[model samples]
Target: MKDMLWLMRNIWRSTIRSKILPVYLMLPLLGVFLSALTYSSAEDETVLRIGVANLDKTQLAEDAVQYLDGLSHIQVQMVDLSALDGEVASGRLEGGVIFEQGFSEGVHSGKPGGLQMVSVDGEQATRHIKGLLAGYVNDLDAIARIAKGDETVFAELYNQARSKSVSLSGEMVDDISADQQKSRQSIGYLITLMLFFAMSLAGNILREKENRTYFRVLTAPITSRSYYVSNMVVHLFVMAVQVIVTLLVMRFAFRIDGGLPLWQMFVLLVIFALVAISISMVIVASARSTALATAVQSLLIVPTSLMAGCLLPIETMPAWIQKTASFLPQRWLLDTLHSLQQNGISKDVYLNISILLAFTVTFSLLAVYMFERNEDTRVFV
Candidate 1:
């Protein structure tokens, strides 16, 4: 036990001394900041600038403008009839709503040419406003029909409709979409970094073997099993630190919520870190040389991470690719993170966790078998 602790301490020191450690820790935070910036800009895109050209100069026309202006996302500006088209076409406005002369009379008489919607971007920019304007026009048409061409009744009904009161209750929903997306992307980058770090640590076994350090260590009070166990312990410690530091920066520094408790995310990531370590062990045990191990690591980690949606969203992938990703441990880790984020604690989380553990055990066993079966691997034993 003392020897294992000593070995772990030495390995930890060596790892922390590397310049690459800082990069690994910083990349996730950088990703989170960039994601936050991108989403902040995207939020601005929701506000639409609309020009209102009211040639009718009636109560209905002004009321429509006020209604649109009162909306949360639409910004209605009163513009001249002549400038509406130019404003919309020149990209100064998203779209325009024009009320031609006699719009009220047309509404009362059930005529069609009183309203026009224009946009350079066509339906994309004007669709929502079109719907809103249609709704407004429909209400006016209903009131006009009820009055039946009586000026006094139409005016009275129009005033009543303008002052109509209905009970409405609203609750602010905290939109975690930007934060959630940032969290997912940051964690995805972290996962890839973890895998690469695991591979780097695992490669030490081959390096030490090549340099006779493994043999030298075994000649001391430590056995082969003890040395390997110490290495695994060190790997776990470094990975745990990676998870902790990255999440801390995300939560406090960036104020981004991943929609799950910090402890829950930590536990899930730690489990994945174990899987990463086991995978690295398999890569190291299967390869005869450090160069071969590196080649295999690059070939396996990036491609598998890509398939697992650690580099891209799983939803964007085709159905067949998503199915194929289900076979990967990283996919299970990410899916578990997503499940917990969306559904909180659920059966799917447990199922995915079990699968991750199963992956760890499977890879650990495979690595052991490979190490034992290899004739040129006396250093491992």
Candidate 2:
């Protein structure tokens, strides 16, 4: 045990002293943080500049403008009718809602009304505003119909909608709103990508083996098993640096919360990263060559990561793929972290930590067995 501790300290010191580790740990973090910060600041709480051009210029058109301008998330810019397209094209406005001439006359006269929405970017928030304003017009149509003693018909139409809507939780939720679920899903993908650094670390392991330094270590008082234990310690320490860099970048550079209880977040990262470490060990032990290692990493890491909900929301994927993801460690780790964020730490947190430790132990044993039984000349391979 003392020897293991001493070996870990020596290897950790060597890793820290190396000129490459600092650079390897810094540039990627800076890049990730810069991208995240730029994106978050640009997208967050952006008050949409919406132009209102009333060609009709009547009381009803002005009322329409008033209603839209009063709503949240939009800054109504009253512009001249001629500048509507120019403002939209020049990016001064997110979109313009133009009421055609005689809009109120058409409404009072029981004729169709034409409204145009123009924008350079047809983003979601703008689309939602357009939908809301369209609904406002539809409300006018309903009110016009109601004025003709058509109460029975309106009741029947409302009943038809009520009958068609049945919720899973038995609560009649009338609105099917997009609730930024994608942001949380994207969060999941980022978490998976961060943990999946194991593959690169595995590649790091293979590089060390190729350099013949691994064999030189084995020739000292270190046995094959002890050498692997030291490597595991080294891998964990390296991943600790990775997590620190990632967190600092995520917070200061990207300006993201990255979930709550910051210490717990690091703990979750360590647990997830341990699984990646084990997976890397399995990859290194299973592969016969560097070419084989790369190929196997592509095959294993790419597809499993896809299934584990790293690239996209597994909830959106087909049922079979989601079910199959249970076999992947990435899925469990992600699910664990998500559960932690959503519901505080649950029993599943302990289960995931145990499962990851089990995987690490199992893979470490296999790697040791492979190293011991193989010819000394090729044990590193």
Candidate 3:
């Protein structure tokens, strides 16, 4: 125990004196701030701008325009038919809806109406606009069928339908807010940065070996097991500090709503930190030199972090890539964060935590085996 504490203290002192520690400590803060800025800008961009060109000048056309304006995700503006294409092409509008002169007449006569959607954007952006217009047309078609060309009765019934209301009361079975999504993304980036920082311990171990301090330590009363344990302790301590500082900044400084208690997030990150440390041990154990270990760490960490949805949401990736993410420990940590946000400590959380713990133990045991079998590496000698 004494030897372990002494080694841990030395590791801490060395880290404090080194230039690399500040870089590692600053990475999470910078990453979180940049990500938050990006997310804020993206949210602003999601509000679609649509233009309505009502050539019919009828009650039905006016109603259609009003309905479009009422939609929560869209901002509708009244515009001329001549301006529709120009506005859409110039990027002032996402899409335009054109109501022809016979729009209301066609609905009254039970004939197909002329409603055109014009947009330079792809089919996906205009799809929702088409759906909304289709709904209005369908409702008009139904009213025409019922009225059988009686305009006065149709008008009366339409107004009556608009005014009628039915009471609705029910408990929310599930709720996933936008704040939760922001929190998940923010936490995901932080976790990825922590994993990368944790892997730096491999370089530390390699440096000690290169300096022959590892041999000097072995000559003392400390066993190789105690030295390794001390490394794990130091790595975990650094990770914990990173996690806490990032979370506090996210909650207080950025005002991000993580959707879960800070304690829960801390617990999840600490578990993932263990997995990261163990994986670092494996990398260091497998490499015979610091350069090899550094190369392996870079090659594995960047690609795995990308696959694990650390850089972007997994849902946006291709199906096969998402499937590949399942094998990564970072993916499991993100999955755990998502589960906690949505379900609030359910069976899924336990399952994800268990999977992370399994990864930690498995990688740790493999690292130990490699350390014991490899005689060229002086880390455990």
Candidate 4:
């Protein structure tokens, strides 16, 4: 036990001294910060500023302008036709309505209406306003017809004027918790990857063998198992620190209400980080040269990140892609974190944790076998 502790300490010291910690941590911190900024849809909440042009300026046009002005949750300003073009071009106004000359004349005569809306978007900008104006005009036109002693069509119009609308349910289509879940879940994958790469073990694995550092370490009263075990223990220790720091920063600095018990979230991340350590060990085990290590790193990083949904939105991908991703341990690891953030740990989340543990054990066992088998001390010249 004491030997394991000493070996662990030695590995920890080597890792921190390699200058990898700062680079690894800062990269993920930057990623999380950028993601936090991008994920917020606050800009979409800005109110639309609309301009109106009423040419005739009669009571009918005034009423139409007032109706447009009275639009709920929108800002309206009355401007002349000249100002309309300039303002819309300058982006000062989204768009507005223009009541043409003789609009009331056409209305009273019961002829087809005359109104011209001037804007970049011909009908789109005015569609809602047109509907409102049309409704008001339709009812008023019916009244005018009744005032003209024609009550026959009013009942017919009212009876024939049926409207259809689709009903929607209030299924938690978007839980307030989901946004934070995705954000934190992304942070988990990024931090785990950064830590895995930043350990500097892969780059140095063959370096020590070439420099006879491994020989010197072999002279120490430690078996090869102890040496590799020490590295794994130290990696796990670093993983713990990384998890704590990230979660604390997310909670206190970002103040993101990820909507779960903070402790449970932390537990989920720590377990995933352990699996990351084992993967890093595999990276080291697979390398015969730094070049080979880099090749392996590139090969694994993109595909693994894809499976983890770190590269793109997995939900937007095909069903087959999502289904295949389920086989990846990284998928389960991040899914666990997302679950923890949405709701406290459940049986399924623990199942993900178990799968991650299985991956870690499998990878570590393979790494140990490779470590034991490696006898080649040849330097890559």
Q: Enumerate residue pairs that collide in model 4.
A: none
lDDT of 1 by residue, 1-381 (tens): 888888888777777777777776566666667666766686675778999988999877788788899988888888998888999888889999888998878887755358788998777877888888888888878887888878789889888877889999999999998788878877887898889888877766786778767667767887655666677788898889889988998899888899999999999999999999989988887877778888998899889888888777788988999999989988888888889889999999998999999998898878767755553445343
List candidate 4 stretches off by more than 4 Å: 41-44, 54-73, 99-175, 178-182, 185-189, 195-204, 215-221, 379-381
lDDT of candidate 4 over 125-196, digit per residue (tens)? 767666777887776576546545343554354334423357887655545654575465546556546545
In TM-score terms, candidate 3 sits at: 0.85
**All candidates: TM-score:** 0.80, 0.72, 0.85, 0.76
Candidate 2 residue-wise lDDT, 281-360, digit = tens: 77776666789888877777768878888666688889999999988877777777677666777798888778767876
Overall local distance difference test of candidate 2? 0.68
Please identify which of the two predictions, 1 or 3, would achieve the higher TM-score against the true structure. 3
Please tell me which model should have the higher TM-score, number 1 or number 4.
Answer: 1
lDDT of 3 by residue, 1-381 (tens): 877888899988877776787788778888778778887786674778998899999888898889889988899988998888899999999998888999989998877487888889677878998987888889888988898999988888788988999999988664436567777777777777776787775577777778777667767897666776788888898888888888899889988878889999999999999999999999887887777887888899888988888888888989999999999999999998888877899999999999999999999888877765653434332
Candidate rank order under TM-score: 3, 1, 4, 2
Per-candidate clashes, comma-separated: 0, 0, 0, 0
Better of 1 and 2 by TM-score: 1
Q: Comparing 2 and 4 by lDDT, which wins?
A: 2
Candidate 3 at 352: error in angstroms?
A: 2.9
Query: In candidate 2, which residue ranges exceed 4 Å CA deviation?
Result: 1-14, 31-35, 55-57, 77-94, 109-112, 118-129, 149-222, 248-255, 298-324, 378-381
Residue 1 alpha-carbon offset, candidate 3, angstroms: 3.1
